[model samples]
Target: MMVSRRETLRLAALGTAAILASHPVAASAASKVRIGVLRFGTVSWELDTLKEHKFDATNGIDLEVVYFAGEDATNVAILAGAIDMIVTDWLWVSRQRSDGGDLTLAPYSTAVGAIMVKEASLIRTIADLKGKKIGVAGGALDKSWLLIQALARRDHGLDLPATSDVVFAAPPLISEKAIQGELDAVLNFWHFCARLEANGFRRLIGAEDAEKALGASGPVSALGYVFHDKWANENPDAVRGFLKASAQAKDLLARSDEEWLRLAPIVRAEGKELAKLRDRYREGIPRRPVAEEAADAGRLYRVLAVIGGEKLVGSTPEMAPGTFWQEPPK
Candidate 1:
């Protein structure tokens, strides 16, 4: 269920207190890093894996993960100082920095989303979407929605909002609606898109393609671990510890299918579900920077400026300096 904004703020204020009360540490104990996460998101998966392997203990940090219901709630918790870090998009990081806030992002996943339609649907191109009831997985301000608008303007000389009927809902509901023929197409997160595709939906386009059209040299990782710059500077070792553990977890998944088998229950993978999960994970695992990747962050800045406008990306269409945490703590 979606958390009410007020309830989210309440949780933000009380979450860490609740955790510390239940799991007390000495005043001079190891550094504790409180992270905000969605209860069912991929970050949650990583946290579970970290706990299962006791990676935090091994890395010498007392990590406390607080669960939020959605991205907005997580953002609120981070800004409220209830959590030191969160798994969120670089776009949000850009917004925060533009506001004189000191948040920075680190790479997490390069899982770009897709627009899906039924196997038998007649919508073969962006132009075909005119007057169709499309289901958007995130809010009206979602990146995917902006990308779609950008695509429409560039490719078909059409404004998506004026040309098509858009309905916003959660990814699961969007997928369900598509399956029931209630929606002509759904623009959803990559994993959900993969799941729907595995269930016989067809992909019309993906955000990677949209990025390319917007002049990105290649696909860019959007979601990342975001933290307050001051907090990160003060807790360099803890920051390094978290990254080390996260890299280890990613490496484990990349190296061993057995790891997925072990996590099958948590991921709820079975048969085709297992195959889709494996495909999505492998597709998203970060790699060494390619030449094309160098242009993505900047291109993303421009794309958001043009498509998302000032409301979503802030006053400047340019990416702020130091938006990314370049030097991993030594």
Candidate 2:
């Protein structure tokens, strides 16, 4: 009528095995992916969707979001092994790889900034920007600013920075100054540009347009999910799963206006501003093939190298090999 000790132990082992088999993710610690993100970054909208829709778990991974105050902090976190991935540009990945680091990127957003002007501003062409006060965010090395400069020189033979009163400041400050009429034109980040559009500002030229004018074939992603090659190779499944989850999230955001409404608070927008932000975010989603994007990036790199010099792209005049991560065949 009583079970033996050996039989009891066998039953316990079977029960534990059954539980682990039913929940595979709980059985493996490697399925957890820690991602570093900016505290106010738009990437959070997609990440929040992933969690809300349970995409990560469906993809067989636990997504952990780590927030930092700035981009540099996120970079430090990923490099110091505090997180698995962060959203950044391929240019940065190329720079790091050239300097003996193994970071790689998966395209995130093709959305880039624009040169914005007030509705009544006389700056209708690149030539009109001469002798005007302009504000630029992300400083002298800002990719969009550099691209705009190249565009001005190539198309109009004007040295934009040299001829204009250029002011470089934080994105928010630049946006504020432009609104206050302290600057005649401004080149700011995408989100800020969206806000400016909502407030009646006009886009003189978009970064994507500038790239095309400067010889790129199509829209190229300027930002992506960056991670170390060693870590990605070791956790291939987790990395792929996370990327799949991210893609699913983007699809949802693209198709659903209700989803954008839900994200309004996080994005700090409402009404016209919210709609503008949503539209711009959707527009920025990367749709080109990886190879196509990489080819454009290589061409764009040469242009940037000419202006940014050794300080911006390091010693590599070309985009480093493997700067864009190609998903392994299924």
Highest lDDT against the true fold, candidate: 2
On the 0 to 100 scale, the lDDT of residue 87 in model 2 is: 92
lDDT for each residue of candidate 2 in 1-330, tens digit (9 for 90 to 100) = 112223433544544353234434332356899888987898998999999999999998999887878776566556655578899888878877776778999999999999999999888998999999999998888999999999889889999888999999999999999999999999999999999999989999999999998888989998999998888888899998998999999999999999998888898899999999999999999999999999999999999999988778866789999999988877
Angstrom error of the Cα, residue 15, model 1: value is 9.5
In candidate 1, what are the lDDT values of residues 168-239, reduced to their tens digit?
A: 898889889989999898899888888887898888998878887888766677688899888887778888
- The TM-score of predicted model 2 comes to 0.91
Candidate whose TM-score is highest:
2
The whole-model C-alpha lDDT of candidate 1 against the native structure comes to 0.77
lDDT of candidates 1 onward, in order: 0.77, 0.86
